[model samples]
Target: MAAVRKSTNWFAIGVTAAVLVVVLIVAGVVWFANSQATSPGTLPESSAVNTETGAIAVGSGDKTVDTYIDFMCPVCNQFEQAYGPTLDQLVASDEITLNIHPISILDRASQGTEYSTRSASAAYCVAVDDAANVPAFVKALYAQQPSENTAGLDDATLASVAASVGASDAATSCISDGTYTRFVTAMTQNTPVQPGSGGIATPTIAVNGTVLSNQTDLTGDPQKDIVDRLNG
Candidate 1:
């Protein structure tokens, strides 16, 4: 894209992004459903969300998938586009729950990481009023995911995008205030691999207790679709 021009110092984005995306997708196995504790039960490892109670496992199914995604990441956008329909079906059938843990790899990989964090956290503020809107808002952001280091979406545009989904101006205001920087930081630092999940990049998905490594996290096998039966 013109925005993510090659003229700049974007040479650094060479192989890291490609490698990161591939590993995350084809590496995970499955999340442990037997355990209720916060620890990683066994092999296949897990991508977890550190919660108040314990480590919350996530993914997509009749149960739940603890999803860790970055807003400004292209792969994340692709995942949403491919799998979001399945998510809607699951929500309708009340068969699956997505505990999405949005992080900020945009800064690490793209320039929009910080802005994406703001946009995401702002959506969180909006979700406080209506939780269903977060997915829709996230979908929009991903649809607009540009190359790394592109900027222009200020607080107003972000808020507008949020409002289009359901978030209010007040929620947008809260996002602009930059309250969730810590959450974003914590997300980036998460490894999300066998050892951990902090160091990993965006769109890291964990089903039940199993971290999926079969296909691309962005465009997986669409388990949500199987349950929904919205096929052609």
Candidate 2:
């Protein structure tokens, strides 16, 4: 009877130890998941703004052209490639002030890598660290935009792209750390509704608060159709 009692006590101790181990494992997993869901803290000064409805102003002109883009959106990339040169010329000539709003709406398309947010965050890093190179950086990013459902460009690749576009070393750290990821997340979540457009969409172009009904109106001709539309 004494031997049986001792055996039962040992069994109980082993079971208790296993239960504690399982509880610790569950707690650790919960903590990790929570951390992943939370933002990384405040954004850098250069890229800081009200992520809900703010934009990065480029060029100062009487006319304001607001462009909303997402790095992972194929249509946004196409729009950039088509109208990018014309827009740049307009900004350079002071004909229009380009308000480039880099938002993240296609994070789901990046195979869980959150490429849209990562790329947008990297752009913000460039906007703050190398303000003059924002256009170049943006062009570079879209030029090499990855296809959906892929891992997308890694941090090192993004940093390298920034460097190619004249972004300083500081931009590299900002990109690697994903400093503006939360900002991008916020912007994506809180996109404002535009008149006539219903909900916000990538590559949405608005001229002086009037969202353009037709994207193909520009026709890639800065001196002709684009200028006509802008002037009109």
For candidate 2, which ten residues in a row score worst on lDDT? Answer: 43-52
Q: Please tell me which predicted candidate would have the highest lDDT against the true structure.
A: 2
- The alpha-carbon deviation from the true structure for residue 118 of candidate 2, after best TM-score superposition, in angstroms, is 0.3
Q: With candidate 2 superimposed using the best TM-score fit, by how many Å does residue 79's alpha carbon deviate from the native?
A: 0.8
Candidate 1, residues 105-138, lDDT tens digits: the string is 5664445346666655655555554565767777
Estimate, for each residue in 53-168, the C-alpha lDDT of model 2 and write its tens digit.
54777788888787888888888888887788888888999988887888888888888998988888888888888667888888888889899888899999999999998889
Top candidate, metric TM-score: 2
Q: Candidate 2, residue 191: CA error in Å?
A: 3.2
What is candidate 1's local distance difference test score?
0.58
What candidate 2 gets wrong by more than 4 Å, as runs, is 1-41, 47-52, 194-197, 214-226
Per-model lDDT: 0.58, 0.79
